[model samples]
Target: MKEEEILPKLLSCFKETVEINQLIQKEINGKDIFDSYYESDLYKERIYKIQDLDTSIGILIGRLYKTSINLNYYYFDCPSQVYLNHIEEREKIYFDENIEADEKDFLLNEIQYFNNPEVNRSLDFGNFDCYSYGKYIDYEERFKITIRRKLEYLSQRLEKYNLTVDIQEETNIIDDNGNMIGYGTEAIVRTKIDKEIEPIETKSKNQLTANQIILLLQEIGFFIHPKIEDASKVKQAELISLITGLHQKNIKTNIQKLDKSVSENGANYQRDIDKINKILDDLV
Candidate 1:
């Protein structure tokens, strides 16, 4: 598309994304849940409880990445299937189906924490639910938000070219002017603004397909090793070995050091794919 058309649409999309960013920022400003009458042993108990839950979530395979999830976060870290099973056993319903708003808010709070732009402390909670809000900027949530904003911008911009362009492949509807309309209670109310527009077959350079991303991660040398039952169990020695290899090659990957915090959330979060991939790779 021409710059004249693309820029304005891009600006519009970015404008909308500001709302999302603000929401995220607001969420991060909230306090940690473990701030209650916290004690050391109690904290350890909570960690193990979550890890046991993670063990189960970690067993299931991920549809998108074909790996175990990190059920500790009880949000994105859990495996889909195992977590689904865990949820079924605990809540008797899926998260999206019957979860209470308060409970969901609580869970999403943790998700938001783990997904915080600054998630460095998340994996290293050290007997506490460690978290950071916006400084890390290296976590998956930031990556997703960044990519989505860009897509929205490009999609809006492309319409100026009189082209039917959408950044998201799953996008089903678009107005004639090429702006995006959100979902509704029933059939989404939308009107086409263009009389006729040609669709673009080209993919965006920055956007990575699910499979492409998986392949790229593999190329970065994040493969499964079955020698250890749990990644978390890796003592200083294993940590040194695994991290050394990755650091030498300049790549980042999580080492679970398996510990069963199965009573935790991700087991039933219904798609903690990342954790599942990490765990199941060895089991399989």
Candidate 2:
């Protein structure tokens, strides 16, 4: 995938991780839930799903590291640091007198692999002893920390890009005759006037197929159960109704609370709200 595509895919993976983590937390740590819930089938199933997502995240991070290196981007340093840290851990393991002789020998033989240019470029650390056989829980905790730091850095950078785009869109105004009229607040006012007078398109039930509607709902952050995708039309329709109610209620609550002035990224908020509304209108 291209460098630009990796970031959005990573963000989606992060979102899935968060949702799954929340479910696990609620099941295991919620006020009324017992600690034994961790051993239940439901918890095991969610943990399996999360493990799959974590693997995907690792592969994506590797890909992102490769892309960053190819583009000579500064973000490459983050993954580089991860690799360096891993190598440091391996060195410590190699020197530790308590470790098995075979393990130290294995590390000594493959230590050059860690320094290989191809290995460095790929950033695939999954085969290392720490990841594959050693203290896995400790390795996983470190990996989670790495993911959190990268997510925070990427989110801040993405927010800056969005702010820059919003500012440019607000200031750069072109008239119907294809001439630049003005800039700044005056341009924003003209743009708002243009939008206010624009014709509204009516949505029809036939405009989007059932599958398309399902995809749109997913795009808007609604978690439609996978079984619904293969269910009967009646069942799918029922699921959609339930999701629509939840989505609309959330919008209603949040929209009322949003301040008219200096709202947190109002452009993105309105855009998502519009998408949900359009899907609702089409379904109607």
User: What digit string (tens of lDDT, one per residue) describes model 2 on residues 1-284?
Assistant: 77888756766766777799998777666455546776789888988998887777777766665575444333212454554445456556665854655543433333223212122222223233111111111223333344334334333333423311011111212344433332111101113334356522333324542224444655655444567445654454456646442222222223322334325534444554566577667886
Output the TM-score of candidate 1: 0.19
- Give per-model TM-scores: 0.19, 0.27
Each prediction's Cα lDDT score?
0.33, 0.43
In model 2, the runs with Cα more than 4 Å from the true position are: 30-36, 69-73, 76-284
Supply every candidate's count of residue pairs whose N, Cα or C atoms clash at under 3 angstroms: 41, 0
Q: Residue 6 of model 2: what lDDT?
A: 72
lDDT of 1 by residue, 1-284 (tens): 33234323323333344444564446446657555524456545545654553343223212212222322222333334433444434334334555654443333332223222222222222444333222212224433443344334333433444432223331112233422231100011111353234222344544433323333344445444453323442242245445332111111112221222434323322233454465447676
- Cα lDDT of model 1 overall? 0.33
Q: What lDDT is reached at residue 241 by model 1?
A: 40
